[model samples]
Target chain A: MTTTTIHIPTLETERLILRAHTLADFDAIAGFYASDRSKFVGGPMSAELAWRNMSQEAGHWVLQGFGRWILEEKATGKTVGMVGLWYPAGFPERELGYDLYEGATGKGYATEAATAARAYAYDVLGWTTVISLIAKDNAASIAVATRMGAKADGTFPHERFGETIIMRHPSPEGLS
Target chain B: MSTLTVQQMLNSERLIMRAPQASDLQAYQAYCASPRSSFVGGPFDTAKAFEKFTAMAGHWIVRGFGRYVMLKDGIAIGHVGPLCMDESVAPEFTWTLWDGAYEGQGYATEAASTVWQHLTNDCQWKEMVIRIVPDNTKSCRIAERLGAILTDEAAPVWYPDSVTYRLYAGAA
Candidate 1:
């Protein structure tokens, strides 16, 4: 049986446009992860790591009917960062994740892109629950999660990320 | 300011806010349909849940701010955003995790904190309130975590069903 590839297209928000990843974005992705300043921004991702990450993002869209979109500047057309859904093996659960360059911080892009992706997920894809795994000490991320209406349940120890907070957003139907 | 677009009102760690679509109905319906879920008033039917989602989306246009649908991993789990209370008291901070499987996962706090930050920091709202029913210990605890205060004041008669309530307000 031939499997059909699901095509999740680029989504546009008020300030940013979420689109599929392309090889052209490599330089921008590399620049962000390669910089020491990017440490606190999101990942300590190296250039090669960022490339792998982008590839994985594209792969997710094909396998999972939904995935993160590469965030691009509307005017400059620069790939400032990435934000969207990521489903890894052993963890069939859907997760909301993001990574932005040093220059992208403080602009509310993370929040903006995330909010749009969430709407698409709930309203479009019909996902019942969404999770965000953040390092406990990542104060900036914690603040972002709070802003998006995510509530932290508890901390889970991750071999790779250390102690991470598991934030949950159930479903709108349950909200009073 | 241009009526806060779904994008403008949204605040999340990794997703953007947008208008609701028909596609979210199934996930939302499943949550409301679940028996184990603890909604504010209780479980809701599909019609009611849809109405609520529409109302929340409309609030962004009517009140300039309101609750928003939450997205994670390309799926809609629940909603967290600003909501108007009676207007007589401080604006209430509200949230709900409709999916039973999602509970105890910390996503509620994660999502709610974002809305709280927007209200306090971005929108510059003076005070925020979280009213919790006495029996709902989980909600009461959540209110406490957000730094809400419990008062001796009698529960408002409006919600006669609410036997007891605690008021959580932001610091002045």
Candidate 2:
């Protein structure tokens, strides 16, 4: 039996292990999508959609050479959220995105995970700059962007998501 | 168990069937945009089709075995083989040729037959099934030619309109 393999790099943070999404991660992802917390992240979907969504995330790594990572809390080895570089078909530019599962917010997990993702984008991927596209009313996510030194640059007219605010992260040179 | 690279999954006389790669997205998206996609529940918007394409490629990592894109003369014409969305459900044998220009030829059947043999003989899969919407007579015909038997078993709830055809390892 020959099996195909996709190489997704694993990164370590102070409190989280940013790693490839495993099949087991689907349970947590489906749960998140089923909840209201997924409201602004194209969620409130059925398990069927969630299954495809997880696969899309994994496939993104293969196709795009970069994609989201599962944010696992080191203390408990439990999944906290997913955060990484996102440049899907609809996006105007490559963006850094994060989604914290229900009960995982308010602990700075999103902020911590996103910071590492942005660093990977600039340092490893050789990206000069990246943006974070947040839903108009997602103040919590906006705050995370602010905490990471991203400034609201403009808004993008998303076909499905409507208008989303685009926060530009500090350029690699600007950071230094 | 041996390991094959992405481009070496399976092969037939006129087609090289391999794991879906980044390069296969364009043709796949074009198919999703075409009206001919109706039989497969498509004609999806760009975003939806992109997600579906990525998922198709990603399923290989998730299940360790997945559908392969059929390349004829270095161009992707279609995809075929096993797909299991849920662990509890039986893996399905599926086939889709992207363009109507390639239809009426035996491409889909040939690709499906090659994949079926690879999975059943080399991979040691004992049983698998094919689910097709009743309106997709072309695909149903391929299932028939592959020695699949129509079964009374209900299709997966996500695809309620489909009918099931079971294929045993030795039957083919």
Candidate 3:
């Protein structure tokens, strides 16, 4: 319910484990922003900026109690990337966020992780609604949202990414 | 110091090298709002500046090390210290002085020198490098003054032509 340094809730799906982000995940997070692939997120940045972003994800857990999570592949116990609830300052509303490393895509991992996260947000966090802000060019993410029962609901003029499609979770309670 | 955290301080003459604070948003926002901020991806409005400012303070929690808020006479003029991003091969020692009024006072060299020692001697880092856009001669001079020798590379996607200077831990 509230911030707890003692424990963090971890979620598991068929092939993935969604857990709180740790410094161990910093390199994956930072390297993502450092590469060209980070273009969809906010990337190709300097190390300090990448560190700043990695710190934000970790800080979000402490401050928001529930923030983006590290997506670990159960098959290898490797952190592929991050996904979960992201409601940072300046957000128009609470959002369902996700991102994956280069090698992790095209395997339905994003859909699987996002579905678990959406449920955690609705059932555990008790949020009435959750939205995923997909950049116009982020076709893969849009497809994942679609497969997870999200639909194009509106558009948000995001400060960084400009126009973004807001996809609403089909069921506010999350898929049972 | 080897045991340094974001909240720790490295005090020296004419400056206090401590971690960033929540209250730094104002001075940071003002600095980023000015045209002089172009070198650092600034000229941001209040909202953008707010995001950038908070991120500076928030970075400490995840990384365990970040820039300290540089203070003179108990006022925040800017930040300085060991900076390393996710993609960096090694950390960089820098004094990112903001506010045009605070320039040319030799604080960059002083703070950077102090930070370099702390990072090398106290922290025991093997080596560190500074990445600067080629046109920023003032910062380049500071790096040179700190005994950093120029070697190209380490530019981000935006600043493709940036100049990199490496400072070995053994340098005086």
lDDT of each: 0.64, 0.86, 0.76
| Best by the TM-score measure | 2
Worst 10 residues of 2 chain A by lDDT: A1-10
- Against the true structure, what is model 1's DockQ? 0.01
Q: Point to the candidate with the largest lDDT.
A: 2
Worst 10 residues of 1 chain A by lDDT: A1-10
TM-scores for chain A over all candidates: 0.87, 0.95, 0.91
Model 1: docking quality category: incorrect
- DockQ, structure candidate 3: 0.19
Which portions of model 3 miss their true places by more than 4 Å? A1-15, A20-66, A87-91, A100-112, A115-129, A136-152, A157-163, A169-176, B1-8, B13-23, B45-64, B71-75, B85-90, B104-110, B131-166, B170-172
A1-176: candidate 1 lDDT, tens digit per residue: 12233365889998899987665776777787778645543456766455445544554554455777889989788888888886644342678887776578999999899888877888888887787878787788878878888998776665456678888765657432
- List TM-scores of chain B, every candidate: 0.76, 0.92, 0.90
Instruction: Residues A8-83, candidate 2: write the lDDT tens digits.
Output: 9999989999999888888899999999888888778999889888888888887888999999999988987899
Model 3 Cα lDDT, one tens digit per residue, A1-176: 11123135889999999986666876787778888877877777876677667666665554456777789999998889889887766787889988999699989898888888888887788887888998888888899988888899989888777689999887773565
Q: Candidate 2: deviation at residue A66, Å?
A: 0.6
Whole-model lDDT, candidate 3? 0.76
* Fnat across every predicted model, in order: 0.00, 0.66, 0.29
True contacts kept of 1: 0.00
